[model samples]
Target: MDYFLQLVLNGLFVGAFYALVALGYTMVYGIIKLLNFAHGDIYMVGGFVGFTMLTAASGAMGAKGGLLLLIVVMVLAMLTTGTLGLIIERIAYRPLRGAPRLSILITAVGASFALEYGIALAYGPNPRAYPVGMGTGSFNVFGVRISTGQLVMVVIAVILMIALDTLVRRTRSGRAMRAISQDPRACLLMGVNVDSVIARTFFLGSALAGAAGVMAGAYYGKIDFLMGFIIGLKAFTAAVIGGIGNIRGAVLGAIVLGLLESFGTAWLGSQWRDVFAFGFLILFLTVRPTGLLGERVTERV
Candidate 1:
């Protein structure tokens, strides 16, 4: 029972990270219906950016001013990653919007490689140590040990999820996004700037992923160029498990994936962690392609 509780705690903590990365994929799919394969790489970039900002600040202010410096770094990371997302949409995706899905898919693959090598050149092909200095303490609840860092990460993920959910459910932009998702041509006819909305969607998704990258860097204490790949893959599985294009589904999927993976690791050993998670993903897709909460989508033809 104690071990079970510990696994549950660890799973929830990891799920928060998955949810953050999944948001970018779901949001982009929501508006554009294109799987931005480069999104995973965008997340990797966010970690590096946060790492640089955090390290530079740590040098200047020492651990005493960590909170203030962290806040500033967070803002910079969100802005930088958000802007990069918009640019990627415009420069990489926009031109191919009306083209075949195959063409856009290839473009996404190219963009992914470009971002990866670009970062490797700029940062060098070495793992960088993430700055430490976040909260440090642990409390036991019913024999489940929980650390302050995990607690903070879970809270931050929740805040981001709530803020995003509210914005999607309540705002005019949200309405526009939904309309475009349903019928982009109709939205354009209704005088909604479909292009701009898609751009904003990319920005929001990338910004959230960036924030998650920051949290992950803090928690894990190290980062690399390919850090987002495995997590991103899991998050996509989560999105698929819940319903790929649904925001609510992404969150639900993330929690389920996190808990399941955590339990799988505990029961089946760490070596088979990914294999188990991915096996479930394949099984789910084969059995129920629409996912747990996903609406059934049909081809136009």
Candidate 2:
């Protein structure tokens, strides 16, 4: 029972990361109908940006200011990545909006490569050790042990998710987002600034990914340029599983995927974790491609 509880707790923490990143995938897909393969690279950039900030400040603040420094660095990273997302969208994707889908997709892939290599060139190919971390203290609840770092990560993730949910459901900008998603041409005709709304969506999505990246670095204690690749694919799977264009579905899918990974790793060994994840993706695609919460939309011929 304790083991089961532990797995569940761990799954939730992992799910938080997936949820943050998956929201980006879902939002971009929802608004632009573009996959934004470069999104994960933005996540990688966030980690590196956090790493650089922490490294530069660690000596000045010492261990006494860890939490404050983390908060500051996270904000800075998010802003940096958010701006980067806007730039990518403006420079790479906007041009191809009227082009073939293949062209946009290829551009996305190219953008991903460009960001990955750009980071590698700047930071080197070696993995950098994170300068700061949430402490190792932990507590047990109902026989389940939870680390402080895990708890912090989960809490921050939940807060961000809730804030995003509110933003999407309660705000006028969110209404515009939904409008654009449903019909951009109509939105344009209705006097909506579709481009501005799309840019904001990318900014919000990328900022969340950035936050997740910082959290991952702080918890895992190491990061690399290529770290975002597999996780990007996993987040995409989560988005698909939850209904790609649905915000709530993205969160639900991430939790499901995380739980699956935790239990699968325990039962089948770590090496098989990716296989299990992707296998489930194939199963979902074959059996219910619209996903758990995705609505079926019939396009007009």
lDDT agreement of model 1 with the native? 0.85
Model 2: runs farther than 4 Å from truth? 62-64
What Cα-based lDDT does every candidate model obtain?
0.85, 0.92
How many steric overlaps are in each model, in order? 0, 0
Candidate 1 colliding pairs, count: 0
TM-score: which candidate is best?
Answer: 2
- Give the range where candidate 1 is weakest over 10 consecutive residues by summed lDDT: 62-71
Cα lDDT tens digits for candidate 1, 8-110: 8888888888998898898888787788888888888888898888878777766544555655676688788999999999999999999998899899888
| Per-residue error (Å), model 1, residue 71 | 3.5
Look at candidate 1 and tell me the lDDT of residue 149.
Answer: 79
Assess candidate 1 and give its TM-score to the true structure.
Answer: 0.96
The 10-residue segment of model 2 with minimum total lDDT is 59-68
- Return the number of clashes found in candidate 2: 0
